[model samples]
Structure formats: structure tokens, C-alpha cells
Target: GLNTADLPAKVLANRALLCSELGLADQRIAAAHQVHGARLRCWELDEHPPRFGSGAERSRIEEADGHLTHAGGLGLLVLVADCFPVALSGGGQVAMLHCGWRGVAAGILERAAQEFDASPVAFVGPGIGRCCFEVGDEVRARFGDVPEAASGRMLDLRAVIEARLLAVGVRAFEHLDLCTSCRSDLFFSHRRDGGVTGRQAAVAWLD
Candidate 1:
């Protein structure tokens, strides 16, 4: 489900619903102010969980594009419209990443992979696929001549993510393969919606 807009009250209400469905307490959900960069922050098991209500919102990380956690009952969420959400889990830890073209080029996956002692299993969630993600010369130059990263004038963002995961020794991985732009009924696409869109969340936590 997409949490519509940046309205705090509405977004919180939607988050509360997701928390209820996931069997988690509202205060235990930890999110970040995503900047579409490769910066990752670790959620320690011993630290206090962030509060969600008014006056306590400062507990959330101010600037980060990814989160890694070895703790249970603390949900790590990455909100996305057209960007890929990559979830990793193994060896008692889990991580969630917000991967757009910039984040991928900045090595967000490789940075997150180093946090796990072993090669973790990955799940690549929905985003804009190559069929609809058209890019100009500047964006294309950042990805080189990788076939999956370029299909004529289009760019496959997930393909770059997959290659990064493989390079980081993550062999066990799954792609949701649903393009957000292509499937408006199922996802929120910023591109398709002309920059006014809700955000879908990819959440992970240790059980």
C-alpha cells in the first residue's frame, strides 16, 4: 500500500496501519529522512526505539538512505515511489535500502553488504523498469555499456542493483519484477504521477 504524500498525520496513520498488520508496536518503527544517497546507519539492539507521536519525532535518523539492524521488534523502513527497495537478511540481521540511480552509482548495496558477516539473501522490490525508465546521456554515462542498465534509450535500475549485489557476493536474491511506473494499480510511481505521488514502503526487521 502507498502512503500518500508527505503529510505527517496521514503518513503516520498509514504507518500505524502497516504496523498493526505486521504485529508491531507503533513506537518500534524506525525510519530515516532519505536523501537518495549511499549513507547507511545501523540500528543497534540496545538503543531505545524511536517514538512516533508528536514531540518525539526527533528520534528518527535525520539523513540516511539505508538502515541495518540486528535487533528484533524494531522495523526498518525505506519509502519509495519509483526507486528500488532492497531488503537483506541473514545471520540474525536485516537491512533495507532505498536505491535510485544515484544511490546505486554511489555503491549503496556494496556498503550495506559489508555489514553482514556472510553473504545475505536479498529481495529487490518494485521500481521503474527499463521499459519505462528512459535516461539521457548523463545518466547513461554513469552506468556504462551494461546491457541491463541500458536498453536503447531506457535504463534498467534494478539490473544495476542486481549486478552490485552479485559483486558483493550476494548470490541468493529475488526480484519482485513489478515496475512501479508500469503497474500504477499496484504501486506509486513518481515519474508516472508527474512528481505528485504517494510512497510505498519496503520494511524489514529481525524476528
Candidate 2:
């Protein structure tokens, strides 16, 4: 997951690059947004997904926390600085999830894995590793088992998430050990920024 939170416009501007990577230069390509909760949505060219906003009539990209696609050339986008940008694809379907502790506890991965047509392959993008993701006992308990990370506390989200995936029978997955909190210069961190930080965009598409 790339952190382009502060640069949604830039990420949007890079549509051509996205197209090239997804082999979608000829078709209209779009991205779905990310929210904190566990609501899932699938995207199509006819109906665009909503983005983050406040309004009565919203698009799926605006409201959905994560998205999957069977449409060719279109991309499922997830923006993250420290949160997990989970990308999974199988059975001609690809899905990207913006997972925080809330999402993990909400069982987003399990839902996604079950929703996927075939076995899903996941990529846990750069985020705050257990070394940086410290939490209190209450929050740690929510995620179930707090692993000691950082100066104090035990709640390594990535490790916990990996275990969750395995528990759900999602055997294909990998985590990029880079920690956003540890490397603030390279990646954005909501924690490092005290809540205000830019975002990186993680995207995937079908060929």
C-alpha cells in the first residue's frame, strides 16, 4: 500500500501509470475509496465507487472502506500511511482492503477471502509494525493478543493480521516489514503525524 493520503489529486493524476500497469490503457479505469469499517463493495465501469466525503448522495468509492473488481482495466485503490493496505487477487477477481485494527477485528479479511472466487493472494503493505503500533490493554484485547512492540505495549497489527488470515484459511500472504512509524521520511504515519498525514496509494487491476 502506498501512502498518498495528502495527495489524492496526485494519485488521481497518475491514472495513466495505473493504466499502464494494469494493461488498461484502452478502457476507463477507476478506483474505490477506503473507510475504517468492514463494509465491502464491488466496482464496475457503469457505477463508480464513492470517495471520502460528507453528503446525502455518495458514490461507492466515497463510502466504501475497501473494494474489489471483476471489471477489466479498472483498479481497486487503497490509500494508507500507516494502516494496512491489503491486496488480494484470485479467481479473476482482485480486492484491496484498507485495514486498521477496527477492520481487522471486524473480520474484513475473512469476509473478503470468502467473497473471493478462488484462493486469494495478499500483500500486507508498509505500515506501522508491532515495533511502532503500541496499544493499551483494552485495544490490544480487541485485536486479541497484544505482541510487545515499540518501547511499551503489545499489539503488532501485522502479525496479528497474518495470524488472522491463516486462521481464516487464507494461506497466501506476505508482509512488507517496513514500518511507517519507524521510517517517517519514506512513508506517512498518522501516529507519527499525530493524526494529520499524507497517504500512499496501493492499487491492483486485472489483465
Candidate 3:
């Protein structure tokens, strides 16, 4: 569900379940108020004091679409419904990004690449696919005249993201290829469910 929604109790409960499975404490989870921009925040456990539990919840970073950290045992989270959740890890660091069309157009992937010291393996999570993500000329224009991104009027969001990551020197890339819009049983899609829908979270942390 929408883990960072106004419902703090429900959000905490959902997080608790994930932390239990991962053998992590829910208090160490860090999140942001994603604004569909290219801004990325990097946190260090030594330099910046770790925020945990209710403190972390209260101090959710604002106006950032991406988060990166070298801090071990600290979870970074990004919530998405139709937007792609891009996770990157390498050289003892990890990052999670909330990438929407606006974020892609604004160069969020490239901005994220700047945060990594070495080539990172990228894992792209599920989102709307080209089959159902039809768009107009404006959206298509942002990604140029690439065939993979433009299937008639449909836009392949995943393709655009993959191209961007590759261009920024990410070699090892994996995509979940699951279309949230089509897989009604497994995902939440803003397009398929209209404006009112819950969000699925993509979370990553260093071991």
C-alpha cells in the first residue's frame, strides 16, 4: 500500500513487516517526499547522525526524487504506483530513485549516476509498459524518436530509463519487466486504477 501516506500507523505496520523479513529495525528506514525532480540526497551515518523510528518518519526528506547512501543497515525507500523504482548498488553504496516521466525528462537518472563512485548494477522495478502507457507528442518528444520508447503513441517508460542508465555507464542492469497496469493482481497502477490508488515501495540498503 501507500507506505508514506498520512496514515502513520498503517505505514509503520507495513514497514515493520519488511524489516522483520530483512532482519532490520523499522526505525532505520529513510524516505522522502518525492517531487518528480532530479534532486538526489546522500546520507552518511558517520557525518550525519542516523535518524531512526519516529524520528526518521518525522524528518522525511523533502523535494527529492532520489536518495543515495553508503551507510550500512540504513534503509532507503521510494514509493511508486505507475512510476519506475530504480535501484543501484556498487562500491559499498546503494541508491533508490522514484522516476516518473517528469523525473526522466529532468535527468534524474543522470543525476543519480553522479552519486556513485563506481559503476553500479541497476535493478529497475515494475511500472506501466508501452502496451498501456500511451502518450501524446509532448511526452514522446522528451525521449526523442526512439522506436523502443515510441510504439505508435505508446511510451515505454522502462526503455527510456534503461537507455539513460546505460548512457551513464551502468553496465549490469536488470528489469522486472512486470507491467503494473496489466498485472492487476500483483501491483498498483495509477493509470489503471485512475487517480486514487495506493503506492508500492522500492527499498534498498547495504548489508
Candidate 4:
């Protein structure tokens, strides 16, 4: 999930530059227009050979919120501003997940966990943590008893996510301890920036 943030006018321009800088141009550089959900799409470094869903450019592969593949070269992507962009890999495969509160409540982690059928290394990316995610009671209830907004309430969403992953047998993981709202100087923050904010994309692939 790469972002078209302050990089350049063309998303792929920045993408191409990034790949060059990171020495990933030889690999399959893949990305998508994300819609927060539990949907999964797979891609490969082959001739896609068709128009896209919106009938735009003929892409090299498919699109969805999550992506998994065994192909050695295709890079997996997911975009985020305040959502949890996760990267998991094991057994010569990798998966990238875009999980917001809705996706989390819908058990996106569980979905990714199920993909392994055993276990995998999960990487939870930087996003709006609970400290900055002040929501009304309705948002809390969606998670089934997370407590009221209780006014000016904030939870450690990182800790919660770790627990969620662990509960599903994901024993190994790494978290980029970043909060968009708290560390606005580093990453984009939609909440703190008042909705008109740019997104930061997270991506991972095998070397």
C-alpha cells in the first residue's frame, strides 16, 4: 500500500522512484486503490491481459484490501492514514492487510490468520492509535463491549491489536510504534489534520 502523498503528482512516478531507490524495480511492484474491507486479491509478475473493474488501465493483477502471493517478485501493497496496515510472511509467502476499525471488528486479522492455517510473522504498521482515536459510544459498541466513549477516552489500540493477533496464534510480530495523531510530524494524520489529509502506504515483499 504505497501512497501518493508529498512524493509527486503521479502516483506511479513516486512508486517507480521508490522501487528504484529500494532496488525493487526488478521485482513486481504492485499497488491498489484500497477500500477498507476484508477482501483479498492476489497478483503475480505476469501479463494481466485485461481491462480493470472500472475499465481503466489493464493492470498486471487484481485488487482488494488484502493480498497474498507466493510469486517471488510481486510486491504487496496497502495504503493507510489512520488505519492499521499489516504485513505478514512465512513459508515463502507474504500478505499485506489494510485494517481499520470496521475491518478489525469484521475480523480482518482473523482472516489473515486463517490464511496461514498454522502461524505467520505479522507486522502492524503506524496509524491512528487509541490515544488519538476518540470516538463516540457507537464506535466502541461495534467492537462488542469496548466501553463507552466515556468522553475523552483513549485506549492502547496497539496493545489491543497485539492481543488480537496473539489470540489467533500469531506469536511472532513487529510493530512500528507510531501514531498518526500523536506523531503528526512523521506520518499523515486524518483525525488531527481534520479529514483533508494525505495517506501513507505500507508495502512488503520477499527479497
Off by over 4 Å in 2: 1-33, 45-61, 145-152
lDDT of 2 by residue, 1-207 (tens): 123334545544555465565555423444444568788777765764332221222332345667878876666767777888898888888888888988888878888888876678888889888777778767777764424322357467888778778776788877788989989679978898897776776777786
Q: What is the TM-score of each candidate against the true structure?
A: 0.92, 0.79, 0.89, 0.81
Q: What is the Cα-based TM-score of model 3?
A: 0.89
Winning model by lDDT? 1
Q: Which window of 10 residues has the lowest lDDT sum in candidate 4? A: 47-56
Sort the candidates on lDDT, descending order.
1, 3, 2, 4
Question: Which 10-residue span in candidate 3 carries the lowest summed lDDT?
Answer: 47-56
Give the Cα lDDT of each candidate: 0.84, 0.70, 0.82, 0.69
lDDT of 4 by residue, 33-105 (tens): 5666677776655633232122234244444688887777566767788888888898878888888877776
Candidate with the greatest TM-score versus the true structure:
1
Residue-level lDDT of model 1, residues 142-197, one tens digit each, is: 88835667878899888888988988899998889999998988998999999888
Model 3 misplaced stretches (Cα beyond 4 Å): 1-8, 47-60, 145-147
1-207 per-residue lDDT for model 3 (tens digits): 433334766766766777777677765776777788998888778643233335354545466888889999888888899999999999899999999999999999998887788889999999999889989988899999355778789999899999988888999998899999999999988899886777888889998
| TM-score, candidate number 1 | 0.92
Whole-model alpha-carbon lDDT for candidate 2: 0.70
Worst 10 residues of 1 by lDDT: 52-61
